[model samples]
Target: MKFLGSLYRFSSSWVGTICIVLFIILFVAQAFVIPSGSMRVTLLEGDFLFVKKFSYGIPTPHIPFIEVPVAPDSDGDGHLFQGKRPQRGDIVVFRYPKDEKIHYVKRNFAVGGDEVIFDLDNFYLRPNEGDEFIEQNYDKSDIVILNGQKYVKEPYKFKGINYNPHFRNAMRASMLGNLERKSLAMRPIMVAESEKVYEYGSVKFNAFYIKVPQDEFFMIGDNRNNSGDSRYWGTVPYRLIVGKPWFTYFSIDPDKKIRWERIGRFIDTLQSDESLIYEQK
Candidate 1:
């Protein structure tokens, strides 16, 4: 009877210790999860990734057993740890600016002092000189086909207001049924421009001409037309960058089949040319 009591006490102590260690790791070391497909191709819908917390420094410590209402400082302003500056093309996970409780992930595109512009399906990055846009091609196959014909789908620039041909067609088809000739003649007028624009696909507008301040980054998803990124919410502050994803630990399809081939895949750096991988495949 004495031996049994001793064994139970030992087990209880070990379990408590394990729980405390796990809490610390999750709080200060790493966090793992299956993120939304907002970063598809680069990060899949059901893919699991590990986010390193310490790559950047830790924030100000709140009083033990009591949550502090003040904003935590990750910069060296007076914090215990000072984070490194984020670089372009680095995949980072951070607290959403609109709602700090929500977490988001995106690839860094531009840093502070950079000017950005989008014209005719291209992205331009300008620092001091005029806008230098980069051409991006969206695969037409990703578009939904209707009636066995190539619908002139319009790629959406932002949300709420339909900018692409596909959205107009969908709205027309839904309202008038089968897109009649009469309905096509009365198509809605497209606004020339607006004072402020949503990031890409959402209806929220904060400001225009995002003059990225020091220690700030502009992030976007690889899936341009389908992603809600810096184009939507504004730039993310550098202190929010959790860390770069290192590897794909697990992947599973909705059908319950484990994706064995993707289990050990290494996440490519932002500067890595995606064309090379596509070519190899």
Candidate 2:
């Protein structure tokens, strides 16, 4: 009888140890399935990506259930593990500014102290003390010049049955033939002057100039028209950043047709080092 009791205790202890280890791993490094198309081409709606926790740094530990009491008037922000700093063009997963519980993924377009401007539908970045803006190409359609100046606009056509041509094209190639002819329309224009203005698609409004705070980042999705990013919410604090995606582990269509080609593919940061020369005033 004693031997059986000892065996039970040993089994219980082993199970507890295994469970603790699993929890740590899941908290630090794990995979997540994307449910929204905000990231689109870079991260598909149904793609599964692996995130390494230590990629950035050790994360601050949060009390499991109770809040720990610290010194009065103490800045007790709970980040424990220190990690590497995030750079421009990195795909980062972070907590939504509005709701800390909700997580979002976007490419880091500009870091703090970087003057980012979107004119003529082109994104330009100029670091502090930098002479000129570094122009990078996001999409061919993102470039739209109005009266010799740049602006951002959303262009859409009713070429597909679902009202979204790009999405339909991704689903079925044969559906291209079934597309009915329709008029193409351009959304409102948004220009960057003293402040940032959003005048296109679902999110349209004039927003004030945002100075990215220290250790903060500006994130945007490649799918500009569909994504709600820094232009909508705000800057993402460095401490809230989760991790950078390394590779795609799985991609499945609703039809159960797996995109074998996309699997194991690395996420590419859409950026270029080439110099852009434009006639200046």
Best by TM-score: 2
TM for every model, in the order presented, reads 0.57, 0.59
Cα lDDT, model 1, residue 257: 80
What stretches of model 2 exceed 4 Å from their correct place? 1-17, 20-27, 61-78, 132-209, 268-281
Residue runs of model 1 more than 4 Å from their true location after superposition:
1-20, 59-79, 128-209, 269-281
Report the lDDT tens digits of candidate 2 across residue range 74-192: 33322455577678767787767787656688878778875454332334444443332322433445544433444323322111101134443432222111122211111123443
Q: Model 2 residue 172 lDDT?
A: 27
Worst 10 residues of 2 by lDDT: 272-281
Tens digit per residue, CA lDDT, model 1, 1-281: 99999777765897867766655654454445556645655566666666665556654433322324245464434235676766655677776777655567777767886655433243444443222221123334433222232221333222221123333344323323312333211122212332333343332432223446677888876555455666555788765565666666887766878767667566663124353122100
- Which candidate has the top score in lDDT? 2
Error of 1 at 41 (Å): 0.9
Per model, how many backbone clashes are there?
A: 7, 10
